[model samples]
Target: MGKQLGFYYNSNYCIGCQACETACKNKNKLPVGIHWRQVDHFETKNENNDRQVDRYISRSCMHCKQPACAAVCPVKAFRKRPEDGIVVQDREKCIGCRACVHACPYKAVAFSNQAVKASKCDLCIDELRQGEEPACVRGCPLQVLKAGDLREMEVKGVVKECQGFLKAATGPSIRFAPEKR
Candidate 1:
């Protein structure tokens, strides 16, 4: 409920390199198939029928103002941090119920086979505390990813909805700069 930290992605600048995914996994020491951050590819024909246009989206937990995952957790394992508004799951309190996984609209929550818990991105709270950007943001080869205060990014004309994203009443924190036509 404090500063709402969020991500901004410029689709025009992304190349679907998956570096962000790699960096997130390495930084969090996540097991295989448990991706806290992921790159998604989309292809569509242009309006003029010239050729296929490919787009890539880097996505993770958006740290929504009303996190459905937190609401559905029977054990109250998920919490939105008061200081930075980062949604985090307390592994110890998680019951592996998968309710959170089902509740999250972005499909960001994943069950970790190694840890036997539901896990999602915490926005690298520790790194943020150190005044460092999240690994995904720092590792992007194209520099397409950015993280900061959501309000500031919005003021700069970044939008919350894009080609692969839908508007959520929860007020997801991430923003997008759509690819140019």
Candidate 2:
């Protein structure tokens, strides 16, 4: 939409804390098993130095440039706003088909068992509409989650490529910057 919708996560600052996850759940009123955001851990060993290093990857909907969730949705519940490029779902229009769930490469989309409909982070649109940060970003203790323009944030070393195929498939708008040694 306004070139102002996106997120940047710096693993260096993330600390594997689940604060973001918890905040999203609380703000959305989601149950225990549902996670709008999840953290991934990557570990590597340096044989020469005899050291083990771990990297934390915090992931959620990238709200792609071309979201598969919107593409496969049968009822057109998922929509991508052209103004700021934000993807959102209309709860009233959803049919609980789960097609979007299968289409999402990052598995960022999920079907809510309680609601019997597909659900994912709407990037806290309600808060953003009021000029506030998403709940998860605001609640992150380490400030790992950030939302703003991708171009501007990238310059601050807070953005990076998408983790895998989702990067190529939808060109996810959000970026990540892992911690440095």
Q: What is the TM-score of each candidate against the true structure?
A: 0.95, 0.88
Q: How accurate locally is residue 155 in candidate 2, as Cα lDDT from 0 to 100? A: 72
**Model 2 C-alpha RMSD to native:** 2.4
lDDT of 1 by residue, 40-95 (tens): 99986677889999988899999999999999999999998887788888889998
Judge candidate 2 at residue 124 and give its lDDT.
89
For TM-score, the strongest prediction is 1
Model 2, residue 10: displacement in angstroms?
0.8
TM-score: model 2 vs. ground truth: 0.88
Worst 10 residues of 1 by lDDT: 151-160
Error of 1 at 112 (Å): 2.2
Give one digit per residue, the lDDT tens place, for model 2 in 25-98.
89999886778788887765544658877667777888888899999998999998877778888888988889
Kindly give the stretch of ten consecutive residues in candidate 2 with the minimal lDDT sum.
157-166
Task: Give the runs in model 2 whose Cα sits over 4 Å from its true position.
Answer: 1-4, 46-49, 156-159, 162-166
